[model samples]
Target: MDELTSFVALGDSFTEGMDDPGPNGTYLGWADRLAGMISTHQPGLRYANFAIRGKMLQEIVDEQIPLAVGLKPQLVTFCGGGNDLLVPGSDPDALAEVYEIAVADLRAAGSEVLIFTGFDPKHTPFLRSLRGKIAIYNSHLWSVAERYHCRVVDLWSMSVLHDRRAWSEDRLHLSPEGHRRVALRAAEVLGFKPEDDWSTPWPPLDNEDWMTQRRHDLKWAREHVVPWIGRQLRGESMGDGLAPKRPELLVFDGLGSAEAGEAAWKSAHRA
Candidate 1:
């Protein structure tokens, strides 16, 4: 809040910016977008993103949290457990307990911690059954934020995401536009004056027939869901060969220039 000089983000694909591909095919999610915004205000801002796709909550805690705390950044944003919630027999309360512990540790290390609630899956086809689990997790996340005095980017309350355009075809990650809106909302939460309104209504949509919708669902299942389940059964992850995009806190190279720092960062990474 006090003109962040250093920031670190920890989470799964949501924070990793899945589906929001950059020029080099890496993610450029809300965290990177928000970091770009912060750099505009303070060009020398140092940022790191420890988020990796398909990571579970415990894996984040064990792998990324300690490193984030070690960085001692002025700001840290963490969002995880969505992957865990999808697994059969997962407990929301149990997940929250571990999550809270990580939050507490980060706060104890003298950083302003930011956490996010799970998005509602009501409108996401094939994911409707997990709505109750996500709700329970979100409620617990709110309580954790309150108790820890941490800031929250309440994704659950973002009605804009209820629109189908906000979701990727997988229905798990957000589309590019959706990530942009989320970055704006995160900026708002961090006490920054965002240029655009995240709550702005999306344009109207065309209606589709039931048979057409069913065919789309089947295609989605075949293309996305089946492979996801296969990976789960094989104990494989999307992040198997991946590493964090920004593993260290460094000055945002393209800050405040005509080309935004995010583009510069992407280009630099590609090089």
Candidate 2:
């Protein structure tokens, strides 16, 4: 809003750009893509991203929200509560309550806030069980957005994400293409005319036998799910020692390649 001279993004792995690896080994998610687009129009746009992987809603509110508000950005995008929904016995209502306070705080700080709903996980293997919970959380997110008058990026209804190819092997993070689509959708929500269309259908897929699919699921469990459970049991987080890729509001000059942007970001933070 107001030409978006400065912007900050807050959330978890999704906002951190998981599965969408950059050349320099960092994740470059939709927020970075959207910032690149904004920079094209406003070449000197200042932006920062405070997202880290495996962050819960409460952690995001506690750690990232204050930093984002202190930046005094013209716009801020937030997407959280997903990691909380993945945990057993977590309450969606309770998460939404805290989430609402974060939104209110940012809005009160005079920043145009953007929010996102959780994606529909029914199509993902081993994740269908949490579909009901995610739906509940999404509903609460919509209500919060309405109450706060914030823009909403409705990921739950983005049918393109239902395709298997849109997800990473972990089934939790989005694939590179998926992240690109999300960026375009975010641009649309912000009333920007994005070059690509998020709704474009993927090429037709070949059918796989049910047994083969089951085998794939088993492999996925061994490769991804088991490790995730192990980390949970050990009370470890993926972001244990990681820092945000972009920590300060600087000119978004390296919009073309996230790798270049990341290098510049690292240099800026180092100084």
Candidate 3:
């Protein structure tokens, strides 16, 4: 309530940190790093990551939303829906519905929602073939965030236009290095910074257990996050499957309603 006492992260692999291809992947994603930095300044805050690797809008609404509310933290961050665009024969309408549901839930929780914007599909190999659709999808995100008055993190603009090197091996998600940069940028934009500097490289994967864990983590992300994005982009709702089936109809459908700000908090991990 005062400063960010609690922080939550919701999203897909990008939010999960799928950069390191090695088996042991600790998901020190950008959100985690951002929390770390905030903690440096705030010290006693709580950090919760509700992110699932391939989570869709519905998944966040279903799972992450409740967790966020229960956590009762002050800050909630969401970065998602990338998989929605990657799936072949995906539906955008469903994706939007799911997103709306998630946003509604976040607002209801009184969170300072930060939605990361998507970039051009051309940034990735698969999406390269769907450039036009990517623009439409990103535009929809901007419009939706504006409607909710949620804080928009221009990841699309920052990643593609300003810092292209932020992408990882897959050219889709952010690399560990990219996540570090993003975390720092978020700190700068939000005016919060911890003692530890994430600009340097984090320790390398030192063991098989770590690698195995990382591999499992990444696999988990690919499964959940991607499908959700696909569902949303296709214009279908994941919960009841009754949402609209067209992206064009995304407009004028405020069949929805209302919401929620900010604070610095203690660091989570600074070594």
Candidate 4:
């Protein structure tokens, strides 16, 4: 079998399961759901979620990518930089540069395939002011993925019909149902699963009890289940950090870690 053991999810609030008011939001975002799907259908699979809230493109370049490479995942996912668009100054070109660096690093670390996600304007705030910037960044994502021969998951076009209700109250995060749909679309795009495979209905959340239950479930998913599953996938004896065979987990060397990034770039280029 093609050892699809280690799968890692990287990015920001959306990746971390932010607004979704279900078991998924607290931690079991689509990454977790996909992991679960893989496990249920294909036993012995393992996965990890390393997403953090409020992260930007620079952060992924400097920090998240390293962490992912250390795991030695056969498959990896990057869903990032929504917060970059939240403000200004960091233009799409700058963000694209960051993405380019991260992708290069991923390839060097032996990740055979990477799944890169695009932004969803429907869920995006400040679109009127930031449309061009978002489009540029998304375009960069497309271009970079193409360059790297990585798969690009177009979340932007997929989430258009889903309105605010599909998202959480903050309008920034996805609702549980919304996350489920996103997972389905992502799976479809990545060829992880077929359209008919998404027939399993996620728990609906229209009332307070469902909301409260979802909150608790979300917490359990992140703080407990995710880490546990990650550990299992790595095939290591019980412990933290990454397996010995995996590379060092470094998201970015640092914003100004020029020496570190230069070393990485040189090393990767040589490979």
Please provide TM-scores, in order, for all candidate models, with all chains considered together. Answer: 0.93, 0.93, 0.65, 0.67
Off by over 4 Å in 1: 254-271
Going through the candidates in order, what is the number of backbone clashes in each? 0, 0, 34, 7
RMSD of 3: 12.4
Residue 242 C-alpha lDDT in model 1: 89
RMSD of each: 4.6, 5.2, 12.4, 14.1
For candidate 2, which ten residues in a row score worst on lDDT?
262-271
Instruction: Give the higher-TM-score candidate: 2 or 4.
Output: 2
Put down candidate 4 lDDT per residue, 151-177, tens digits, no spaces.
776766653424555666544567765
Cα error of candidate 2 at position 37, Å:
0.9
- Record all residue pairs in model 4 with backbone atoms less than 3 Å apart, i.e. clashing: 62-251, 62-252, 63-251, 63-252, 64-251, 66-250, 67-250
Model 1 weakest 10-residue run by lDDT: 262-271
Global Cα lDDT for candidate 1: 0.85
As a TM-score, model 3 comes out at: 0.65
lDDT by residue (104-141, candidate 2, tens digit) is 99999989999999888778857789999989888998
Q: Write the per-residue lDDT of candidate 1 for residues 1-271, one digit (tens) a residue.
A: 6767999999989998888876566777788888887776677999899999999999999999999888888999999999999999999999999999999999999999998999888887677899999999999989999998999999988999999899888888998789988988888888876546789899989999999999999999999999999999999999998899888889865323343344322321100
